[model samples]
Target: MKRIMIVDDSSTIRKLINYILRKKDYLITEAEDGLDALEKLIETKVDLVIADLNMPNMDGIELVKSLRNNFYHIDTPIIMLTTTRDENLKKSALEAGVNLFLNKPIQPNLLLYKVESLLEGEKNE
Candidate 1:
């Protein structure tokens, strides 16, 4: 079973994603924000991390930087989700080491597809 960490400030979004991934039999871990997610990562080993761009107390960009700098998570795949269409923000995320960026109002099938593709690639590697 693949483990995934979801970091978002919105409870509704967290629950929605948790529901979707749970149905696929993926182990789900939820964090209210980047800070919480970082704490969780210290104790939990996750195959992937799905995070919202705008979050309090660190934000997704900072989290990505932290993860990339950390030896344990340097190769971990990260998918950043955001409602913003800002090209600069997207560029920043890419530079910060995000593997993929998905816009908000994400379609369930698309999310699943990306998640599966990334995880499958990881397995192949």
Candidate 2:
């Protein structure tokens, strides 16, 4: 089973994503923020990461940078799921190493599709 880490400060958002992805039988890991995600990632390796942009402790861009700098996670696919419409932030996120940038209130099917695509692509690599 593919493992996915969902990093969001909101419990409701985390649960919602878990509920949606659970249908696909993906193993889910939840983190309250980027810092928690990084700590957990040190012990648990995930196939992909879905993170919120504006999280306390460490935000999405910072997390992406840290992950990119880490040898273990340098090639991990990251999806920034944020509600922000700021082009500057999005650009920074992409530069920081996020593979994809998705807005909040995302469609379940779309999220599933992207996750599947990213995992499949990684497998091919």
Query: lDDT (0-100) at residue 78 of candidate 1?
Result: 98
Candidate 1 runs further than 4 Å off: none
Measured with C-alpha atoms, the lDDT of residue 81 in candidate 1 is 94
**C-alpha lDDT of candidate 1 relative to the true structure:** 0.92
TM-score against truth, every candidate: 0.97, 0.97
**lDDT score of residue 59 within candidate 1:** 93
lDDT of 2 by residue, 1-125 (tens): 99999999999999999999999999999999989999999899899999999988999899999999999899999999977666779989988999997888878999999999999999998
**Tens-digit lDDT string for candidate 1 (91-123):** 888999999988889788889999999999999
TM-score of 1: 0.97
Q: Rate the local accuracy (lDDT) of all candidates.
A: 0.92, 0.92
